[model samples]
Target: MAPSLDISDWWVKETQKGTPVIVTTKNHNYSVVEINSPNTAFQQVDKDRGKKAKRLDLFACEEEKILNDVEPILLSTKRTLHNSSYNDGDRLLDEDQSWVLNNVFQHHPNKATKMGEKIDYVTVGKHDKYQGTRCFFVISTNSFRADFSYLKCLKNYVKEKYPDGVKAFNQKYFQKRRLKGMNQQQTGMNQQQTQ
Candidate 1:
């Protein structure tokens, strides 16, 4: 759900001061799905989601189930949660239970699509990024416009006002920094190898 720009001066004000916000869902454990980003709150328009949307304590639900069902385990929060004192489920998919979903798609493609649609516990949907593979997004979105108009305006202004400044800064510090650093390290290693 994208919000229409009806209000001329509408902008998202940051509510959380970086002190860790919590979600409302009880079972989201990030096991089978990846919470790409668990943010983006919006006011609900419909009857069912209205209450949750208005709640100040709740954050926008974010989840992404890999179409291949082999979503990288690195993204899973299971280890971090289990190891940490904060065992509370952060509404991400449970990594421990993700073992059930590991080879569902590779071994059975047809079952994946069918299960995706009908299954209540496991969310199923067509993958937005990859074609033909079925992916599921369990998070229900709100009627809010997700855009970078604010960033776009800022970018345009910066581009117009400080083209040389950005270029110079990148040239001095940002541009090719990674490649240069890696090349230097590799060159040193090569020199050592030759010696």
Candidate 2:
């Protein structure tokens, strides 16, 4: 039987606020931070082990927190790339990663408007790892405002494209938004919301 899903509140909390984060995989004990910078590349720690050892460092302006938290799962599957095993094939990729990435991209804020343009976005790449478990690093562009706006647009775009997208989007957005709003309200942003 397949394993059950483990969804953590930590990942949702960080992503809703658009905060970049550092994710350390428990299985691999590998740590990486998602930042807003282009031109960053994933380093190859070893090349003898095949694709599972390779890591991709990518950049985008959106979903830094969500993406970082879900790295281990996004690339999970049963597919092979060269004659070697990867998260997608050998169960290296965590299932959680797939869930978060799929949900986030599908229902992100304002996703509809930025469907086809060169908007601020997030990009993922892959590399090789040795010694420990496979690892992937995420990067984002330097402009936070642009990235957030683009993500928002993308979310809306998806909603427009798919009839059921908005329903899910609304459910996810409101839950996180309410929590974040409460946190902000305590931090003295309550007055801003009323105005």
Candidate 3:
């Protein structure tokens, strides 16, 4: 039998600030948090679990099973989602997911055509850096358009479904600083107006 978690150990430490520390022992990670009145943090965990259950149901649906033939398409989507640069309050767009999907489909058009399926849209959430985030999606073949449209659609669909957690994390550590460049044409026009 598994040992009960010591919930007190999972409390976010003052030194950790916004980041929660998770300790791994015997292959399991545990978080320490205070269990107090209302337990808003615990409530958030339940909400997340519910959302995950819903996504699993969608994955188990008959129409979605068609994507199984092109499972790699989904893997590729995961890779992209794990590699996106997102910030807090940033809204994920279907187009971003589509870009990754299109790349994957172009590489495996034949398999995609055989499956007759595509990804439609995805939902994602915010996080602090390359950490936990959720993604959800609606999958379909009918809405796919473009060369190898079916495959591209699936790729896009899966990508849009999940949050780009890993990418966001990496961004937090490796942010770049660069000066903004003015458009040459616009600058010239402004100069002329001033003259």
Best by TM-score: 2
Model 2 lDDT tens row, 1-195: 997443444445654687445665434423353433222223443446454333222212132333343334333411212216433223224453343235444455544433334333332222222211222222224333212222343345445554444455434433464576456545454444467
Query: Per-candidate RMSD vs. true structure?
Result: 23.8, 24.1, 19.0
Please write out the lDDT profile of model 1 over residues 27-110, one tens digit for every residue: 443212222222322333346645333331222122112111212332242243244433222222455234323422222323
Per-residue error for 112 in candidate 3, Å, reads 24
TM-score of each: 0.15, 0.22, 0.20
For 168-189, candidate 3 gives per-residue lDDT tens digits of 3223212221011124335555
User: For model 3, what is the error of residue 86's alpha carbon versus the real structure, in angstroms, after optimal superposition?
Assistant: 2.1
Give each model's clash number.
Answer: 13, 35, 19
Better of 2 and 3 by lDDT: 3
Give candidate 2's TM-score: 0.22
Q: How far is candidate 2 from the true structure (C-alpha RMSD, Å)?
A: 24.1
The per-residue C-alpha lDDT of model 1 at residue 23 equals 48
Worst 10 contiguous positions by lDDT, candidate 1:
143-152
| RMSD versus native structure for model 1 | 23.8
